[model samples]
Structure formats: structure tokens, C-alpha cells
Target: MAYERLYILVEGDDDKRFFEKILTPLFEGKYDQVKVWKYAQQKKEKVSQFLKSIKGMNADYIYVSDIDQEPCVTARKQYIQSKFKEIDKDRIIVVIREIESWYLAVLDDKSSKRLGIRYSNTTDNVTKEQFNDLIPRK
Candidate 1:
């Protein structure tokens, strides 16, 4: 089913920015709106209310988080499930190393020029450290 609006729930501001700049382009022309919602600092009540509201709109949510300190993606998902109990298991995405890896993954030649970052074609096992290290110094 195609949702009119899609919400991507992520861990922090950088995740939000990455989704907005990188992932949103992939979703463009498909979803009417692709919202990258950073849920880290939101109050529990606000987060709960926002999730509840999705049911009333033509929207679906995907939960994305880094596999930080976890043994594996399954373990990380299990941990997140404890908090986001109401969400379906399939909606959760625990990045292999971290969301930063995705930022690197998207930095192909054209994207790098557009985003002003260096290109990277080999981010299969990369992490946040690489992402941070590649950040433009100005």
C-alpha cells in the first residue's frame, strides 16, 4: 500500500538531517511528504501523541536507530521493541554499524558534489567515525 505521507523516526538531529537531505530524495515523487522525525529529545507524552496521530492520516512510520553497543541488529531491535512496544517488528531498522554508514553509502559522486562531501563507494562496514572524519572542515 502506498501512504500519502511517510514518517521516518530516527535517533538524533544528524539522523534527521541525513534523512531529509539524502533519503528524502529517494522517496521524492513517491510519497507526498517524507518526514524525518528525530525522536530522541521529545517528551514521552509528545512522542506517544504523535504516534497515535498517525493512525488518523494516510501515513506510515518507520523506526530507524543505530546498532550502538549491541551485539547485532536483532539484539538492537529487541531493545528498541521494549520501548516502542506498539510498533510492528518489521518497521524497525537497526543499521549495521550506525546511521552514519548510510550517509557514507549515499555519498556517490553526484551526491557528494551536491552535498559538498567526498565520495565514498565502499561503506559496506563503515561507521559514524568515518562519517565524522569525512565532514568538511571550513
Candidate 2:
């Protein structure tokens, strides 16, 4: 199916970049454009206004957020739904743990070795703190 346009609302730059680098290409011919919007970057007021601006535009949007501190995806989705009433409950994509793990999950062995970290196919267990620790400190 072809989409006139697809908007992906993500929590941070990493998620936006990920969608751009990976998802956008896959939708090359399927969508006229795949725009990744980092909702976190916008001021709360601006975001709300922006959502209102886009209302009734016949646009397709998918919201993505991290499962940070939330007990479950449902709760997170509920919270976001409350804030962004325009967002459909079923359209939110809550990243398991965080987006970092998803990136790590796809890293090749050479990339993992270059980063001086042992990688496993399942990166769901990798936390931001653990990944941060891998960075060389001056």
C-alpha cells in the first residue's frame, strides 16, 4: 500500500535518526515521504499547538516512545494519550527498555568489537548506563 506521507513521532534524536536511516529507506516507494519528528525537542506548548495544527489534515502518524521508568507499555501509552489526545492508543510504539538497545541489537560483530563491547543478538538487556560505561573516560 502506498502512503501519501507518514509521520513518525519519536521521543529522542536517536529514535528519529534510526527511523530515518532504517525505516525511511524501506518505505522508499511505499511512501511519498517519511518524516521523523522528535517530540521531545519541541516545547510542550509548541508540541500541543503543532498537534492541533495538523488536526484533520488526513495525515498518517505513528508515535514511538521509550519504556523508560514506565511499568508497562500500556501505562506509557495512556500517559501519552492523555497528553496528546490526537494520538491513537494503538499507534504508539514503545521501545523495550530504550532505543539504544535496538541499535546495539543490529550492530555487526566487527562494530561491536571496535566499540570494545561484547555483543549478543538480543540487546534488550543492554541499558544506557551499561552502554555509557563502555565509553573511554579521559
Candidate 3:
């Protein structure tokens, strides 16, 4: 399906930056524009407000959040679904552990070593604390 625009609501600035770097190139000619909004980890309230504000807007919405401390991915997905029942469940993505896990997965082995992180093919086992240590502070 063709979409006029794509709206991505993420947890924070880091997630926004990550998506812009990764998605912008892939979606450059697909949509008129792809906008990423940072909800600052304030999931439910911010999402509710965004949905209400864009009631009639012509755009595809994608909500991304980290499954932190949740029992499992299913439970996390259920929580997000309960918050915004109107949105399509397919658009909701609950990242395992955290977005940092995604970063680690995408980074090449050389890059991982440069960042002092042992390259792991699977990120599901990586903890947030371990990922935090590898990130260079600005």
C-alpha cells in the first residue's frame, strides 16, 4: 500500500537518531517523508495524545519501544495493544531488551571490537547494562 507519509514514534532521541540513520536511506523515495518522534519513554500518555491529535491525518504510524523488565515479548506487546487498541498491532514493535541491542546486532564485528564490545550474532542475550558500557558518551 502507498502511504503519503510515515510517522514513527520511538522511546527517546537515541532511537530517533538510529531510525533516521537506518530508515531514511531505505525509505527515501517510498514515502513523501518519514518523521520520527521521540516520546521520551513516556509511552502510554504520549501515544494516546499522538493518536488523538492525528485522528484524521493521512499517515502510517509505527510505535517502537524496548521490552524492558517485561516477562516476555508477548506481554509487552499486549501492554502496548491495550494502550492503543485502534492502532494496527503489526505497526507496534517491542524491541527485545532495548534499542541498544539492535545497535549491537547491526554493527559489524570490526566496529563492535572498536567499541570494546564482543560481537554477538544474537542480541536477545545482551543486557542493557552491557550495551550502555559500549556506547561512547557525547
Q: Which lDDT values do the candidates have, in the order given? A: 0.78, 0.79, 0.78
Q: What ranges in model 2 sit over 4 Å off?
A: 1-3, 108-111, 135-138
lDDT by residue for model 1 (25-126), tens: 998788888888888899867776777787567477888888888898888889877875666678888777777776667556998888777676777667
* RMSD from true fold, candidate 2: 2.7
CA RMSD of each candidate after superposition: 4.0, 2.7, 2.9
Backbone clashes in model 2, listed as residue pairs: none
Q: What is the TM-score of each candidate against the true structure?
A: 0.73, 0.83, 0.79
Indicate whether candidate 1 or candidate 2 has the larger TM-score.
2
| Arranged by TM-score, best first | 2, 3, 1
Best by TM-score: 2
Using TM-score as the yardstick, the better of models 2 and 3 is 2
* Best-first order by lDDT: 2, 1, 3
Q: Residues 1-138, candidate 3, lDDT per residue (tens digit)? A: 655777888887668888999976787687888888887656677678786665567577788888888898778888878878766678888888778677778778998788777877788767668877777789
- TM-score, cand. 1: 0.73
